[model samples]
Target: MMALNSVARADSFTITGVNGTGVTASISNYSLVGNQFTFTITNTSVAPGSTGTITNLGFALPGNRANNFTLVSSTNSNYTIAHDLNATSGSQNFVSSFDLVLIDKPNGNPTFGGGSVKNGIAGGTSATFTIAGDFSGLTADQVAHAIFARFQAVNGDGSDVAGNGTSPVPEPMSMLLFGTGLAGVAARARRRRQGAKE
Candidate 1:
């Protein structure tokens, strides 16, 4: 078998009953590269109501300081990043906040999934978006321990979702070590087979 240099691991979780707004959110995909974590969020309709618009999204650092977090990039152009101090104070302050607005559109409908706005995400309709950033000067274990995300939709509705237990893939060196052990076992087995044949 061909050797692998590295492997990527992903974890996901669903966010339901978001502040009782009948809108559900989920982390469809999550990955860590170095100190950066890239993730995708998918929002779906849960009950009957107007299509709730996402107002803000925030990520908390828990015990970490605000300086440890950095804003990398977002695929949505209408969203802006800022610091959210309402969640906590002092060094335990939340990392960053993303504010979203629907502009130049009638009915004030928010657009997701590459600028397609529908009346409501209800009836099995859904929208997906992505956010990525770096947690500066932190190890993989540290990053995994610090994955807490909060999101808010219009009318002061929101929800909190934690991205914990999402472990990083095994390092290339570990894979190599495992491969070496398997090779040795195979060689021994082959030698035993030849001795029996003789």
Candidate 2:
């Protein structure tokens, strides 16, 4: 059996295949439930004449535990360039960015995930948005947690959803376990001190 803690994680996840169109990103086998997790996607590179939109904002948390994790809310925005500089072809050049963050835990707790995007593109622009999960009904103060989540962006032709055409992998469970271990150590130390005083 494992426990949950508030320690931060050192593991990192790479948002690859996020090139031309976008990426359908998700997490799986998360032990934590009833807690909202937020993620973001940014465009690194785009075809000179290509365009797309950020929609279909939803996530799936398996285990028939809709109560575990639910898509409570989402926010997205972008900047588009009307035309190329020093050009008279009247061809509009559009550059877009995306940002997503976990503003609050599902139980209406004030906590955040990751950080925000500074620029707009994958390399140039950086956009940020957030998806809040709701875990208000859970009974325990320290509930087990895990997650399976994903998002996608598609172009006029759905075949080109991902710019690089790859998938996003889940972060390692080591950090989560490390957090549990550290908590155990702290608890043990406190217990020892209390016993000495008695």
Candidate 3:
């Protein structure tokens, strides 16, 4: 059984594009509790047809936050959570350094449904990650836009799939509002010009 975790108004983000098959992508969940942050990442697709399994989630910490956070534990024994990861795991590349990585062992963990020969997050299975931080504001605002996912095939046919997400994905929405405000300004300017001409 998985550990007893607080559901507590969790926040989620979408991850997509794995091996072009688009199989097993996810809308993962996360929450913060007193400087201890917990999140669940699952690989599954309801529409069917996913060829790859998610192998790891690598969080690229911003600035020099490598020492601020530490991997407390993973709910699954088949997984290993670590800090100060500067390299890539499978096909997931890191453009920045000092990452927190949760990786599925190559040996694989058995939790029913035959077995994941590749030791990845099989469809419908989830791993809740717990991370402890020394800082006070250890909220999603600090970790948003810091996540990337990796995938692989147990049979080795595929595993080089990578996906990234910004938890709140703020840019596009902010842009929309900014665009609207600019358009309004432009319209007002045009109206003033017409009044002056009159």
Candidate 4:
């Protein structure tokens, strides 16, 4: 079997959700270069000062691949890398389907058997997580159909986000294109609002 960091490639996939308007997430694989892998969740449903939190997120592993379980870090404490997220203390979903999970806490949860729901990922922000380890044989397909849970301020106070899609690797160009598209959409809406105001 090929070990991780053997090749430098990025793969990306879409994560769909409900009870919220236009909520989505993405996972970018970049482990082949010994750099890092990231998962970003964007919630665009809740208004300002409202609370729309992503409490749980799980990624599946195709062909029953093993988790390397190395290091987990993020720009903020909103999320912690929990290859094995815990669900006993607080609450979590998708323990059997998803092979990896980015949890709200990461003290002893280094394996994907459970989960947590503390200070979950916030809404209206692009919360990105950096996870490192031996993810040899991991591909973009594994993350295509992601599953997650959100709480508060959504369509009737949050719901589960789950679905599947293509297995295109998260290339930098692809991410840029996606980001640009989102920006374009936002700009158009902003202009429309401005026009309405005028």
Candidate with maximal lDDT: 3
Error of 1 at 152 (Å): 6.4
lDDT, each prediction: 0.42, 0.30, 0.57, 0.50
Ranking by TM-score: 3, 4, 1, 2
Worst 10 residues of 4 by lDDT: 86-95
Looking at candidate 2, the ten consecutive residues that score lowest on lDDT are 80-89
Residues 1-198, candidate 4: write the lDDT tens digits.
Answer: 533333323554555554235555544443333434555555543554334456655655555545674446665575554554442222334344545666555425454332343455555555655666554555433333344544433444544553444454464555887999999999999999999999
List the candidates ranked by lDDT, beginning with the highest.
Answer: 3, 4, 1, 2
Task: Show where candidate 2 strays beyond 4 Å.
Answer: 1-34, 45-51, 67-130, 134-198
Candidate 4's C-alpha runs over 4 A off are 1-13, 18-22, 26-32, 47-51, 83-95, 106-118, 140-153, 169-198
Tens-digit lDDT track of model 1 for 1-198? 766422233554544432344555555445556655655555544344622443334454434444434446555444444443343233323334222222212323332112223332222433333334445554333443443333333223433222333444555566889999999999999999999999
Runs off by more than 4 Å, candidate 1: 1-10, 66-68, 88-198
- lDDT measured at residue 124 in model 4 versus the true structure, 0 to 100: 57
Best by TM-score: 3
TM-score of each: 0.45, 0.32, 0.61, 0.52
Candidate 2: tens digits of C-alpha lDDT, residues 1-198: 655543333332333222333333322222223354433444433444343332222222222232223234333332211111121111111112112222222213221111122211233233333233443443111121221111222333332222212333323465676888999999999999999999
Positional deviation of residue 67's Cα in model 4 after best superposition, in angstroms: 4.2
How large is the C-alpha RMSD of every model relative to the true structure?
A: 9.6, 15.7, 8.4, 14.9
- Preferred candidate (lDDT higher): 1 or 4: 4
lDDT of 3 at 108: 47
